[model samples]
Target: MMTLLSAPTSPYVRKVMVVAHETGQIDRIDPVFALANPTKANEELNNQNPLAKIPALVTEDGAIFDSRVICEYLDATTSTHPLFPRDGKTRWQALTQQALADGLLDAALSARYELLMRPEDKQWSGWRDAQLAKIERALDRMNTDIPDTLTIGAVGYGCALGYLDFRFPEVDWRAARPALADWFATFSERPSMQATLPRD
Candidate 1:
């Protein structure tokens, strides 16, 4: 079994958990609850991930950091329902869509840190607005063409959208992106997503 540094409310960690469940490899994972937060560094987690992020998988071979890499590793190792497409234009599309969804997450987190983590005196509203703009653009793209297959792109979008709902409910993402919202409403029903919902 592999050890996964996990935090209950971390959307990145939640993404890996959902991937594990979707790939039918959840049993092979041993989740070690860790209270990792952006405000402080975790020495133990840093041992596994130099950047001290959760969802770091300690494998027999070594350690894999970042949810994207870990999720791909799981998909590559699993023979069952692969979340990542193997080849063709569809594969490229899936990878690209995954990047788009991940960008939304990155921007959202950047805004969060700027507004919530930094001291009010040091926080820059311009920087926060810039990040939020990136998220809005990404969401517009996702709404224009939502993923139709259960690929890595879908998984990434699911986690990103869920995180927005969990943290930025005031954004009203559904107001303009009805297609993306509808797609996510259905995706949220998946057992993998249902089991990995982020909680306080």
Candidate 2:
């Protein structure tokens, strides 16, 4: 079995978990909660991942960090249902979509950390606002480009939007993007998504 270093509140970790469920590889992963802080001394997580990030995977041979790499590895490992397309333009599209979704998550995470993790005196409103703007722009682009049907990109998008709902409800991302809200309604109903929905 592979050991998955994860934090329950991490959207990136949720992405990996959703992909694992979708690919029927959930049973192979053992979820291990981790707390990694640069200031914290003597943490083994730093050795496994020099960056000390969550969603790190420990396989038999070595460790893999970052949700994208782990999800792709899991998809490739399973022959039954591939979350990422094997070849051609579809693969490119999926990769691009995943990148967009990841970018949204990255911006959102930065905003969140600035508000929640950083000391009040150290918080930078300018940086937070910039990240929020990036997220809004990405959401707008996603609303325009959303596919009529579900695909790898759609799955990633769904997870990214779901994270916003879970962590930043005050932002009201849906009000301005009705189409995306509707699309997310359908996307969120998937069994894989339902199983991985974040909870308290």
Best of the candidates, TM-score: 1
Residues 16-43, candidate 1: write the lDDT tens digits: 9999999899999999987676778788
lDDT tens readout by residue for model 2, 1-200: 99998877778888898888888889999998888554575377887888888889999989997888998898888787567888988788888888999999989988888887899999999999999999999998998888654456877898899999898888898898899899899888889889888876
Q: Candidate 2 versus the native: TM-score?
A: 0.93
TM-score of each: 0.96, 0.93
Worst 10 residues of 2 by lDDT: 35-44
Scored by lDDT, the top model is 1
Separately for all candidates shown, the number of backbone clashes (residues 3 or more apart, or on different chains) is 0, 0
lDDT of 2 at 93: 81
Show model 1 residue runs off by greater than 4 Å.
Answer: none
Error of 1 at 103 (Å): 0.8
